[model samples]
Every structure is written in structure tokens, then in C-alpha cells.
Target: MTQRTDVVVIGGGQAGLAAGYHLRRLGIEHVILDAQTAPGGAWQHTWDSLHLFSPAQYSSLPGRLMPAQPGQTHPDARHVVEYLAEYEKRYELPVQRGVWVDAVHRDGTCLRVASDSGEWQARAVIGATGTWTRPFIPAVPGRREFSGRQLHTVQYKSPAEFAGLRVIVVGGGNSGAQIAADLASVAELTWVTRRPPRYLADDIDGRALFDAATARRQALDAGHGDTGGVASLGDIVAVPPVRSARDAGLLPAKPMFTRLTSTAVEWADGTLAEADAVVWCTGFRPALAHFASLRLRGTRGHIATVGTRTVDDPRIHLLGYGDWTGPASATLIGVGRPARDAAREIASLLSG
Candidate 1:
């Protein structure tokens, strides 16, 4: 027999948990299904040596603040995962761990969701899975033929692991810069960006840059955008962008790479760089393929919609998509707004 619920959440991350909490507050019943043995999806898969660029004050899930001293940096991967685990216990959220959802289909008034554990029939379904379900590694020609250790930035942890080795760090985004910088001291590092990245220092002291970026990202996503790139708010304000890093000879400012041969990377300008390992920080993609019926509005992976409502299906919603450019958009702040709205929408459908 298929168990039933008012709604079924596809993920158990911050988005899913927040949605579930809101549903409960409205007296709506829902179940959270997650594949991981525990909560914190990205954090569970993230490398050991990582910290949120955003500070503790800004990274709270929803109701609880990330416990920390005022100036302490935001929690690391371990701290995040532990905090999420504690969050589950605190609210008694009805989450089924280790239940990987395989497919979802509409069944009359309710949606049928099949998972590893069993099946669920729900009046509505929230795709709170977030955007990082799939890693977006670019297709470099002859990549398969390369014999060296090719790894995605998602699995990377520390620079010590690649110490004394020649490594090619691909992509110009935050991950690429941070990783390349960290590895430079220990390894022979070469940084390659498709284009120059606009780096912003958060505060004058440079200690709170992550928080600043998160704030900007949040604003942009909320549609109340600000001057793009980066802004430093407190402490030391206005530090140079990463272009200065290039000028200072801390990194190489090579043009975009043409292609990757089995043993070397060909630059756009007729140059070959040898590498023992290539760290592709190409970014992430949304795994919307699982829901075959949810149509995307445009060529972009984004599902075009009016506000938080999906254009294809009002019952489905996406949050934390890169669309929000303000500080809270990318970070955990203000996510509660969309999740709460989504939960209310689902409850309304169920009540009707």
C-alpha cells in the first residue's frame, strides 16, 4: 500500500527542513525524503577543509542562529553538518533518512513519489532539492584519455593533498580562486579562467569579504539588486579585486584554454600547459531531469515563473538558485521566505 501525505519534500537540506517546519506550523502534514544517511546535502559531500564565506550571524538556517562568538568566522563543513543534525532533533521534523527518490509522477489529484524505501502519495510536491544535485564539470576534449588524476572541485578538501605536485585549477569563480590560492603555497599551481573574475573584498580588513558577497548575492536574487561585483561593509572597507592578485604575480593571467589534450591543456593563444592534475571548478547544474514533466521556460536551466511559483507547475518551486544576486540569495538567509511561501501554497492546495 502506498503511504500518503499532504505533501512530500524531495530533499532534506536546509530548504527541505525549512519547508517542513513551516508546513508543521500551518498544521499541514508532510514527510521529508533524503538519500543521504544524514542531513546537510552539500556539506555531507563537501571536502573537509571548507568554511562558509558568510559569517555565523548570516548563515542561520531559519529560526536558530549558528552559535558562535560575534566575530568568529562562519561554521566549517563539520559545524554545518552538525548544526543541521541538531536542527532535525530540535523540531522533530518528520524526515526519512536514506530514502532516495527515484521518480515522481502525477497521480490524479495527488502526486506519486517512488523512493528506495517505499512510495508516497501526496497532494503536492516541493522540489526543495536545491541546485547542487549535479556537478557541472565542463567537457574538455580528450579528457577521458588523460591518465592523470582529474577531479572536480566538489571532492577537493585541502592543498596539502596536492603538495609539491603540478596542478591546473580550472574556472575563474570563487572556488577556483580560493582553491588555487590555497594550493599555491604547497603545489605548483596554475590558475585558468574562461574570463577574468570580478573579485570583491568584503571589509577593509578583508576578514569579512565572504559575508559581503553573500549579502550582495542575496539582494540580487531578491530582485532588490545593488551595484554588482563586490562590496565591503564593515571593518576594513574597499580592498582590491582579484585582478590585483594577477598583477601582483600571485597567479597567472593566461587567456582561456582552447582544449585539453590527453597530457596537456592547449591555451587559446597557442600555448600548452602540462599538468599532473586538473581541478575543474566548473560549477553546478540542477538535476531537474528526474521530473521529466516539469517544463523549463527558456533555454536556460532556470524554470521561468512568476515570483516563486514555477511557470510549468504552480505546485513546484525552486529556491537558492543563482538568480538572487543579493547577499542572502546564495547564502542561507531569506531562503525562509520562498520555502515558507511554497509551504503555504502546498497547504492551500491540500485544503482546497
Candidate 2:
């Protein structure tokens, strides 16, 4: 059975919720298909220790500010889930949970979205599926030969699970720093990165990052020279746990090792260390396999877009995939603008 609508937003996470808000505000009939079984979106799937980079008030959806958690400067994952679940209820967003989208392809003048629950034929499709489902690990040589467990950030939770094990935490991003910090007290931890990890100023948080991104976007829109945004500051923000761990020398990062062996990893200058497990915090690619039938990806695995609307197929838009789609769009506070853009553009396209 094919259900017709003006829009079909995939992934009922933050991005999808953001898009739904704008679509509803514009009176655009749409439904959000979320793969998750419950409300929180991807936040529910994050590690037990995961926390937002900014305060709850600073990180929020378009129309709702996440109420402050009583004692948290930065709300933990559960708080975020609570906020999201409540936000969905408050706005009464049309979300169909537990529906995994199988594929999206052109069907005449519309886009046909095939999913586990049913089918949706929409005049425009918002591909808001974020990257949490697609964790990426670099193709380091001999990775398969590792003797012990290999885990990605998506699989990681509390550090108690790997207590006393020799663990190498890989990647230079915030996830790497935080997870390594979490493991310091219990595990024999080695934090590995391609280069020395860069830490932003102690005071910097997601607020600063968002402001810098806004400045950069404005400068570019004004036809001015490039102003480096978050990258200009540093890769990892000095979140409390990371700062404590780094300042205390509990999170010293080693240069990335050359390859893995049956029992250990070998470094370039003839150094080797035995490891019982490896935890990869290397980040994620956009969860876009469902859009494969659209044949829209470039060699670099992205669809060309003018704002959120795909240049290849104007009937489709992408949201919250990262900076490429919109400045800081993947963050909780960042997805709103592109979502509104997508809604406006879809409104204009369909009306014409």
C-alpha cells in the first residue's frame, strides 16, 4: 500500500524531528519514519557515559529549549533522550517508530520510499538519516588478525565492561577523548591518533563552535574570504571529563600504530604494544544506503546540494549529515536552519 504525502522524512532523530517541526509549521503534510523502537532517536543508542558538548539550554530543537537538568552543566544522554521524547509529544510530530526504510527511488514525479512498515510516495523526500547507524573504522592493515575483541564507539558503553584489559582507543575526535577518559581508571589505556589531538580552549563549548560556524557561513554568504570556523579553534572541545583526564596526564595520545597483529599493534619506529582490545571512535559516515537507488552520490560519497535540496534531484533534500549539508547541521542545535530551508524549498517546489 502506498501512502501519499507532501514529504517523507527519514530517521526520527533530532534532524528528522527538526524537519518535521518545520514541515508541520508550514502545514506540509508529512510523516517521519524512524528506525528506532522508541522516542529518543539516536541519543538512546549512545554510550552510557555520553554527554552533550554544551548545556541543555544551548542545545535544543527549533521551537523548544531543552529544560536544564538539575545538576548537569552538560546533560547526559538520558536527559537528551527525555527531552527528545517529550519534544515529540509536545509538538505531536507525526512519527512512525520502528520503521526501517529499505530504499528510496524515483517513482514518476514523486519519490517512493519503501520501508519495513509500508510505502510512502511523497512529492519531496527529506533524507534526515544521521550517521549514528554507520560507524566507520579506517582500513588499517591486519585488523582481522587481532586476537581480542574489536569494538566501535557504537558498541561501547561503560568502561566496566573492559576493566583491566589492555585497550587501545583509536581516533582523534571528541568521542576518542571522552571514551579514553572514561577508561582511564579501569583499563590499561592507550589513546592513539593520526596526529597529536588538538584541544580547544577550556572555555570553549558547542556554543562557541556554533557561533564560529555562523560567522563562517555569513562571511561566505557575503562573498568574503574563508573564515575558519570550529576547525580554527581545535578538533576536540575541552569538555570536563576530557580536560580532567588530559590535565592529569591520564589521556596521553600516542601516534597511530602501523597495523594490527594477532596479539598486538606495531608502531612505525619499531615499537609494539600488546593489546587485548581495540575501541574505534573514528566517527561515522552518513547513513544513506537507503538512498542508493537514487544514484545521487558522488565519488566522495555525498550528494551535491544547493542548501538542503539536492542539485541532482530537487525533489529530495538532505538534513543533519554534517557541515556539507549545512553549517554544524548534525549537532542538536544546528539542524534547524537546514530543516527550515528544506521545508521552504519543498514548499516552493511543490507549489510550482
Candidate 3:
């Protein structure tokens, strides 16, 4: 028997939860299908030392604020996991755990969401599956011949694993900087980036970045050009640990190497740096493989979205995939507004 629902949210992460919150407020019936057995979404998969670049007050969902811990400025991965679990319980959101969605296709006027557990025929489908699973590693020449350990940011757990060894951290983003800082304390670390790393002012944090992004988005929406230069949330924020690393003169980043040798990396200038492990913090791509059958994906593998709704399919909305869906929508605080609007749109569609 095919289960029927007014809406089927294809992820129980922050975005999905936010959508559910708004849907419930509007008296709409929906179910959130989560692939994970537990709560926390992608945060559960992050490294132990990972902390939010924003403080607790700035990193919250709609209708409820995340409680700030005493003496803790930024929330860690475990704290986020706990908060997400509590948030789900507080709202009594209808989330089905361990239900991995395989594909979503059009069935008559409704959307058919096929999963490992069962199929759901929903009037609308929200793709809130974030980019944790699709880690991106740039191809480098002679990468296959590298004899040392190679791991992406998704697989990184602790710097203790690379302690006392020569490690090379790749990418110029926040993850690369943070991981490089963490490993610098106990390991011989080399930071590599395609271009020079950009660091925001010491006083700046994730909250400022979010505010800047919001302003830029609002300006663009109002038919005005963004004339100011604002640092994105992806830029390094110089958190306490990062600052400490910088003060110690250990945060120097080198240009990307040309190729990988068995136990060394060859630079553009033909300099060889021996390394025991290489950590690629190159970031992630949207996890939209389940929607491949819909044939809505563009050349970049991302569906064309017009403010969260698919350009081709109005009933299909994407959340938390990044700026294309909505500005800063990938963050906790950013997902709320878009989710609210998406829920309202879905409600109107169902009613009509």
C-alpha cells in the first residue's frame, strides 16, 4: 500500500525540521524521512573538535532559540546534536528515522518518494538533504600513486590520528584552515590552497557574515546592486583556536602542489614536501542524487530553483543546498525564513 501525505520532506536535518515547524504552524500534514538512525543530521558526522563559527544565540531555528551553555561561546558538534534532538522532541515533529529515500518521481499529479522502508505519495516534496554525504576532492596528477594515507574532511575525526606525522591539509576554506590549525599543534602540518586564504577581521564571526549575506540578498531582492564588499560565511573567521594558531605563527598557507608523489608532494617550483598523510578539505556538493530520475538537474548536477521551488516542478522545493535555493539557507538561522515561505507556498498549492 502506498502511503499518502500532504507533503514529504526528504531529510530530517535542520532545513527539514524548519519546514516541518512551519508546516505544523499552518495545520499542514507532512512527514520527514531521515536516513540517519539518530538526530543531529550532518553535524553528527563532523569531527569531534568541530565548533560552530557562530555563537549559540546566532545559531538557532525559527520559533525557538538554542540555549547558550555557560562558559561556552561556540557550540560544538555534540551540543548541536543534542539541541537538534531536543528541538525535534519539543515540536513533536513527525520524522521517520532510518528511512533512506532512493528516488523521487512524478506519479500522476502527486510525487512518489520511494525509500528503503516504503513509498510515499505526497502532494509536494521538499528536498532538504544537505551536502554532507557528497564530499568533493579535486583531482590531482599522480594522486593514485600516493602511498600515504588520504582522507577527506568527511572522514576526519581527530588530530590525534595524525600526531607526530607530516600532514598536508588541502583547500582554502574554513574547514581547511580549522583542520590545519588543529593538526599544527601536534603534527608537522602544511596548508595548501589554490589561492591565498582570505581571513575576516578578528572581531567578525558567523553572525556578521550571516547579517552581511542577508543584507546583500535583501538588496538584490529590492532590485538594487550589492555595492559593498562583504565576506561570506565560507571565509575564515579567526575563532579562538584559529587565532591561537595564527599567534603562534603556524597558519601560513602554501600554494597548491602540482602533483603527488609516493611520500611527497611536488610544488610548482619543483620543491618536494614529504608527508605521511594528506587531508582534503575541499568541501561538498549537494546531495541531490535521489532527484536524478526527475531529470531536473542542470549541467552542474544541481536543479534550477526559483526561491526553493524547482523551476520545472513547482511541487518540488529544495532547501539547505546553498545560495541557489536561498541566501545562507545552508545555515541554521538562514533556513528558517525560506522554510517558512516554502511551507506557506506548499500550503497554498495544496489548498488550491
Candidate 4:
């Protein structure tokens, strides 16, 4: 049996929930299909020590302001998870959990969304699946043969498991820096980067990253040149913990290794370091596999989009992947505007 709806949102994360909120406000018939069994989206899978760079007020969804965390300016992962769980219930959003959308195909006037549960035929489809499931690791030579416990940011939980061991964190991004800082006291930590990790001025707050994301988004939206968003690897915010780690001389960068030697990493300088574990913090690509069937992706492996709508297929809109779709579209506070615009456009199309 084919389930029919006016709009089908392929994720139930911050992006999908935000879209649902707007769709409900517009009185549009919509359903959010989520792969998770419960709420909290990807926040449920993040490390226990993780905290947002932005404060509670700055990280709100469209209709709700996340309550401030006690004694902390920025809330931890648990608090964000609780907020997401509450947000969905408060709005009575129609979210069908555990429905992993596999592919989307053209079906005359509507798009056919095939999922684990069944098929949904909808007038419009919104792809909001964020990148947590598809954590990226670079293709460094000998990575496969390295005789060390390898993990990505998604599998990281705490420093408890790596105590008194040599752990090399690879990548120059925020996650790499944070993980290196996190394991400093617990492990014999080594930070490797393609380039020296750049930090914003200490006086600059975390809000600066958000500001840069919004500004870059505006420029892209205005038909300006395509530049990377704040999420790019080079721009590390001087968050309190990261700053402390840097000031204490705990965070040091070794040039990225030329290759991995069975049980070690060999740098271009011929320096070899043995490691008990390696954490790959290389950032993620968009979770766009489900979109394969539409043949919508251009040569760049990304759907050519104009303000969330696919240039190849007007019936499909890709939201919340990153700034290419909207300002900070991947973040909690940033996804609202794009979600709103997508909802309004979908409503207009349905009405016509």
C-alpha cells in the first residue's frame, strides 16, 4: 500500500523537525520519516563530554527556546537531546520513527519514497538527513593495514577507554582538536593535521562562527561565489576547553603522516610514532545516498540546488546539509530559515 501525503520529510532531526513545525503552521499535510527508534536524533549518539559552542538561547529551533543549562553557558549533548525530544512532542509533529527512507524515485506528479516500512507518495520531498551516520575518514595510505583500534568521531564516547595509551587524532578540524584536548591527560596524545589548525582570536566568542556561517550563507544565496561555510575544517573556535588545552601547551600539531606503517604512522620527515589507537576526525559528506535514484546529482556529487530546491527536480528540496542550502543549515539555530522557506514553497506549490 502506498501512503500518500502532501509533503514527506526524510529526516526527523533538527532540520526535519524545523520543517515540520513550519509545515504544521501552514496547515500542510506532512510526515517526518526518521530512522531512529526514538527522539534526540544524532545528539543521542554524540560523546558524553560534547557541548555546543553556542549558548542555549542561540541554539533554539523555530518555535522553542532551549532552556539554559545550569551553571554552564553552553549545554551538553544530554540537554540538547532532551530538548529535541520535548520539541517534537510539544508541537505534535507527525513523525514516523524507524522508517529509514532508502531511495526516492519519480512517479509522474509525485515522488515515491521507498523506506523500510513502506512507500510514501508525496507532492514534495525534503531531504534533511544530516551527516552523523556518514562520518568521514580520509584515504591516508596504509590506514587499512594499521594495527591499531581505529574509530571515527561518531563512535567516540569518553577518554576512559584510552587511558595510559598512545592515541593519535588525525584531522585539523574542531572535532580533532577537541578529541586531542579531551584525551590529553588520559592518553599519550598526538595531534596530526594537514595544516596547522587555525583558531579565532581568544576575545571572539563562539557566536563569531555562527555569524560567519550566516554571512557566508547570505553571500551564496545572493548568487555570489561559492565559498565554504563555517563548518569547514580550518576555522576552530576558541571554546573554553580548547583554549585551556592550547594555553596549557597540551595541544600540539605534528604534520600529517605520509603513511601508516603496520603499527605506526610515518611522517614525511621520516618520523615514526607507534599508536594504540587512531581517531579520524575528518568531517562528513552529506548523507545523500537515498537521493541517488532521481539522477539529480551533478558532477560535484551534490544536487545542483537553488535555495533548497533541486535544479534537476523541482519536487525535491535538499535542506539542512550545510550553508550551500542555507546559512548554518546544519546547526540547530541555522536550519530554521531554510526549513521555513522550503515549507512555504511546498505549500505554494500544493496550493497551485
Candidate 5:
């Protein structure tokens, strides 16, 4: 038997929870289907050393603020997981754990969400499955011949295992920097980037970046020219650990290499450097494979979205994919506004 609902939120992560919050506020019937056996979403899969770039105050969902721990400046992955678990419990959100959504397609006036557990016929669907599962590693020449340990950031756990070895950390993003910093204490680390790493001012954190992005978005929406001085979240925030690493002269990065040798990496200048391992922190792609059957993907394999609603399928909405779906929707605080807007839209559509 197919269960029917007003909405079906895929992936019970931060974005999904936020969407559920708004849907509940509007008295809308909805169910969240989570692939994980428990709560926490991607936070449960993060590296042991990972910590939020923002403080607890700035890293919160729509209704409740993440609780702050005394003397703890930033929340760690475990802390975030605990908070997410508690948030779901507090709201009494209807979440079906371990229900993996396989595909979603239009079924007459409703959408059919097929999952391992069951199927849901919903008036609207929200895809909040964020990018953690789809880690992106750029192809490099001779990569297949490399004998040394090669892993993406998704598989990284602790630096302790890499002790006394030569490690190469690839990519210039915050993950690359943070992982490289973590490895420096136990290993000889080399940071590689396609371009020079951009570091934001030490005083700036995720809060400031979010505010700046919000202001920039508001200005553009109001028909004003881009007030381009605001810094983006892409620029690394000098968090305490990262700051310490920088002060200790361990945060320097080298230009990207041309190819990978069996036991070493060759630079653009044909210089070879041997390494025991290569950690690729190359970021992620949206986990939208479940929607592939819908054939709604536009340029760059991204679903065309105007505000959270899919341009190709008005009944489907995307949340927390990134800026392409909505401004800063990938972050904790950023997902709320879009979720709210999407829920309101869904409610309006269903009511009509």
C-alpha cells in the first residue's frame, strides 16, 4: 500500500529537518525519509578532527539555537550530531529511519517517492539530501598507477594513523586546510592547490560570512548593483586550530601537481616529490542520483531551480544543494530561509 502525504522530505539532515519544521508550522502533513539508521546526517560521517567554522549561535536551525558548551568556541562533529538528534526528538518530527529513497517521479497529480521500505505519494517533495556522499576527486594523469594510499576527505578519520609519514593534502578549500593542519602534528604534510589559497581576516567567521552573503543577496534581489566588497564563505576562516597552525608556519600550500607517479607526484615543472599518502579534499557534488529518472537536470547536471522550486518539475523542491538552489542553503543557518519559503510554497500549491 502506498502511503499518502502532503509532502515527503528526503534525507533527514539539517535541511530536511528545517523543511519539516516549517511544514509543521503550516499544519502540513509530511514525513522525512532518512537513509541513516539514526540521526546526525552527514555530521556523523565527518572526520574526527572536524569542527564547525561558525560558533554555536550562528550554527542553528530555524526554531532552536544550538546549545553552547562552556569554553568551547566551536562545535565539533559529535556535538552537532547530538544536537540534530535532540532537535528531531524535540519537534516530534515524523522521520522514517533507514528508509533509503531510490527514486522519485511524477505520478499523475502526485509524486511517487519509491524507497526501500515503502513508497509515498506526496503532493510535493523536498530533496534535502546534501553533498557528503558524492565526494568529488579531480582526475589526474597516472592516478591509476599510484601505489600509495589515496583517499578522499569523506573517508578521512584521524591523522594519528598517518604518523611519521609524508602526506600530500590536495585541494585549497577549508577541508584541505583543516585536514592538512591536523596531519602536520603527526606527519610531514604538503598542501597542494590549483590556485593560491584565499584566507579571510582572522576576525571573520561563518557568522560574518553568512551576514555578508545575506546582504549581497538582498541587494541583488532589490535591483541594486552587487556591493562586491563582502567576503564569501569560500575564503577560509581563521578558526582557533587553523590560526594556531598558521602561526606555527604549517599552513603554506603549493601549486597543484601535473600527474601522479607510482610512489610520487610530478609538479608542473616536472619536479617529482615522493609521498606516502594523498588526501583529496576536493569537495562534493549534489547527491541527486535518485532524481536521475526524472530527467530534469539542466546544464552542469544541476536541476534548474528558481528559488527552491524545480523549474522542470514545479511539484519538486531542492534544499541545501548550494547557492544554485538557494543562497547559502548548504550551511546550518542558511538552509532555514529556503526551507521556510519552500514549505510555504508547497502549502499554497497543495491548498489550491
Candidate 6:
């Protein structure tokens, strides 16, 4: 028998769950397919110490608030996962987890989505799989020759794992800074950036400016043309200079790494930096390869879309994609408005 629905939601994370919630509210028939055994997607596997920079209010979804007191920091990955599990049970959201979708294809006017269990046909599909699906590591010369272990920030869990190891963190983004700062006391840490960082002060208060900026970044990634303009990597905010760590000599400024072979890092000025380990805070890419039919490509093979619409196939939607506007797109606080907006768009298409 061919199972049919008005829409098929891929990924049971924040975006997909929100989309399912709205669809149910509108009385639209849909089924959520998640690869993981539970909700919360990548959060289920994130680092143990990871916490959101945004406070509670900004982290809330459209219909409910994340449990927290005023002025408290955003929940950590474990809390987030538990919260999503609660959200699912609270609303009785119909999400079928532990079933990985193998492929999705357009079948006539409907979409044919396949999972390990079976296939589903729907009038529309929502790609709520977040941007963290693929970690973006740049190709530096000699990377293959380096004998040390190299890992992306996504694979990183705790600094304790690297205690007493000489580590070089590449990229000056918040991830790099946080990782460097966290490991400074436990390990030999060297922070390397290609250029000076554009740092922003941490917002202790959950104000509109902070929340709105996050929402805007999410919108940009969702294919919504709502941002002002683009700027260089240096324009993205970084952590304030770690004067204390610096003064303690725990955080040393290392030269920009120009090449990475199998065993060593060649600095821009021709010095060799040895490392027992390397954490590439390079960034992430979209998880759109599964939708090869979309034919959307940009510089470096990036997808070109604003909020939900893939630039090539407006009929298709992308959720939780990052850098749609700039660096802010990847944050949880920023993804809410876009998720809601994309939900509305998805709803409209399904109804039509």
C-alpha cells in the first residue's frame, strides 16, 4: 500500500517539529521522518558541555517557551534534547523516528520519499535537516602528510579528552575561540586565525536586539531576502580578546596556518607548527546532496536560497541551513522566525 500525506517532513529536530506542529494546527496531514532514534537531531550527539549563547526567551519555539528562569543561559545540548522529547509528548506530535530516509524523489505531482521501513507520498516536502549535517574543512596543502589527528569542531566533545596534548585550533570563529579558551587550562593551546577577528561582547540580557539579530540570521539562511548585506569573514563577531588567559600565557597567538599536510602545519611566514591534534573550526556545508535533482549550485557548490526555497527549485524547501545572511544563521535563536515563516510557506503550498 502507498502511504500518503499532505506533506513529508525530513528530520525531527527543532525546525521539523515546529513545522509538524503548525501543520497539525492547520489540520494538514503530514508525517515526520527522522533518522535518529529520537527527536532533537544533532543535539542528541553534541558535545557534553555545549550551551546556547542566547537566553531562554530567544530559544523558545513559536507555540511554547523553553523552560528556564529569566536571565538564565540557553539550555545545553542534553537539556535541549530532553526538551524536544517533552515537546513531542506534550503536543502528541506524530514523528516516526529510528527510520532513516534513504532517498526522496518527485513522483509526478507528489513527492515519493523512501525510508528503511517504507515509502511515503506527499504533495510537499520540508528539508528541516540542520546545517551541521556536514562539517566544512578547507583543503590546506600538506594536510595529507600530517600524522596527527585532525577533527572538525562538530566531532569535538570536551577539552579533557585532549589534556596534555598540543592542539592547534584553526579559524577565528566563536567555535574556535570557545574551544581554545576551554582547553587552555587543560592542554597546550595555540589559536591561529588568518586575519584579526571582529569580536562582539556577550549579551547577558535577553533583549530584542540580540533576539532579532539571531532571527534575522536564521531568515537569511532559510532563503528569505531580509538581511542588509554581506561582509568578509572578519566582519563576523568573535569573542573579546582573552586578556586573562593571554596574560596567564595559557593562550598564545599563533601565526596563520598556510598549509596542512599529513603531519604538520606550515605557517604563512614559513614556520612549521607541530601539533598532536588539530580542531578545524572551519565551518559547515548544507546537507543537500541527497536532493541532487534540485540542481541548485553556487560558488564552492553552495545552495542559493533564502528561507525555504531552494534557488533552483522553489517547490523544494530547505530548513535550518546556515549563513543564509551571514555568520548568525547557524544559531538556535535565529532559526525560529524563519522556521515559522517557512512553515507558513510550506502550509500554503500543501493546501494549494
Q: Sort all candidates by TM-score, best to worst.
A: 2, 3, 5, 4, 6, 1
For candidate 4, lDDT tens digit of each residue in 297-336?
A: 8887768888888898887898998877887788898889
Clashes of each: 25, 0, 0, 0, 0, 23
The worst-scoring run of ten residues by lDDT in candidate 2 lies at 300-309
The sequence of per-residue lDDT tens digits that candidate 2 reaches over residues 269-304 is 879889999999999998999989889989987689
C-alpha lDDT of residue 124 in model 3: 98
Global lDDT for candidate 3?
A: 0.90
Q: Please, what is the whole-model Cα lDDT of each candidate in the order they appear?
A: 0.70, 0.91, 0.90, 0.88, 0.89, 0.70
- The segments of candidate 6 whose C-alpha lies over 4 angstroms from its true place after superposition are 69-72, 204-249, 261-263, 298-300, 323-329
* Candidate 1 residue lDDT tens string, 100-193: 8888887886778988788999877777676666778877777887777888888788877899988999877667776776677678888888
- In order of lDDT, best first, we have 2, 3, 5, 4, 6, 1
Q: Across residues 1-352, which tens digit of lDDT does each residue of candidate 3 receive?
A: 7999999999999999999999999999999999999999999999888888889999999988999866789989899899999999999999999999999999999999999998999999999999999999888998999999999999999998888999999988889989999999899999998888887888887678767777887887788987342554347878888889988999899999999999899998899999999999999999989998999977976688778999999999999887678777999978998999899899999999
Candidate 6 displacement at residue 324 in angstroms: 2.8
Q: What is the lDDT of residue 287 in candidate 3?
A: 94
> For residue 175, what is the lDDT in candidate 3?
92
6-103: candidate 6 lDDT, tens digit per residue: 88888888877877777777787888888888677788877666666556666766577788744444556777787788888787888998877777
| Candidate 1 Cα outliers beyond 4 Å, as residue runs | 69-71, 204-249, 294-302, 324-330
- Checking candidate 5 for backbone clashes, the offending pairs are none
Model 6 gets an lDDT of 0.70
Error of 4 at 62 (Å): 0.5
Over 213-286, each residue of candidate 5 has an lDDT whose tens digit, in order, gives 77777888889988553444455777788889989998888999999999999997889889999999999999
Error of 3 at 31 (Å): 0.4
